[model samples]
Target: MSGHLLMGALLTGILAGYGIAIPVGAVGAYLVGLAARERFAVAASAAFGVAVVDGAYALLAVLGGAGLAEPLRPIAVPLGYLSAGALVLLAGLTLLRAVRRYRGPLTVSASSPVRAFLGLLALTAINPATLVYFLALILGRGAEGGGALFVLGALLASASWQLLLVCGGGLLGRALTGARGRLVIAIVSAVLMLVLAVAALTGGSPVG
Candidate 1:
């Protein structure tokens, strides 16, 4: 790849990392909760898990396996709907839990680091938009060569950004360790998730 192309790839990777990571979806919420209950080690592992899945999808896209996009295209609408519904359901459950005055540290019983990793990995992998993003990148460039470098850049960017998020959450968790503070954060997060989920379902976008 030319220097310009490499730079472009790097820049694109950064943007993609920020774009995907900024959304406070289920995974993000879970990360925050995990960090609040556990330590940075768990959160970092989960974040890395997410990055690995995202990187895999990016690679698939760059390799012109955009054909994978085809199978998903048929179910895109349904999956979007389902994802939105699931988000809503999760939000409702969260809201209910909040209202129930459940005051206890968040805990995942008998859950290992590997389970957390796999959970996030599977969650991110199911997101078809990741592939769509890669396909868009490949089509825009009109060439698949040098995609390995591009994928590497994107993966690095994504991993860095995700790790930062986990660290930030961990810090926040440390700062907000009181019971009242945790409750407030949990309530706010649940409310926001509900709103986002509603918007996502009604917006008619394939993946919002």
Candidate 2:
């Protein structure tokens, strides 16, 4: 019975992880862009950071259960707004940097893996989606007998998917290096991110 429960919890966690990670929303857009500019190693660190946060949130959901909603709900809206604002700012900065690169000589600053990890961790943490999603699952009967195993599953699932995105972004970076189309890539990425930001800000799914 214990083994059965553990397996059930692991499966539930995997599903929940994929469910949340599969959505390439504003957060996803930023990660892809980060990977393109920062290389696979740094981006991989960032991806791991995101997965860790997911796992942490999953653990919270299972441990706190329904009680998790109380503290989370009040901050969810604020976090959602803050996240949207940050994305908007990021989109603007991306475009500005792209233009500067186009106009003249641009200096590239190297970012460390640790910095990337912490930056992505903080960025992902601000998104209320991970918390709310896991909380919903808990309330919806998803976390029964779930615990650390569940968090491990969620972390694995999220890590796998996010790393896949990093791979694609790395490939994109390699392809676009010194290519004229790189500018177009920057514009398109920024525009897509901006559009998503607007949608999130105006729509009810800001945190999502």
The prediction achieving the highest lDDT against the true structure is 2
**How do the predictions measure up, each by TM-score?**
0.78, 0.88
lDDT of 1 by residue, 41-90 (tens): 67778788888877787788876565676787787766667666665665
Model 1 lDDT-worst window of ten:
199-208
| Over 4 Å off, model 2 | 103-109, 206-208
Residue-level error in angstroms, candidate 1, position 36 = 2.7
In TM-score terms, which candidate is top?
2
- Over 82-117, each residue of candidate 2 has an lDDT whose tens digit, in order, gives 777877777887777667676766456366789878
lDDT (0-100) at residue 158 of candidate 2? 94
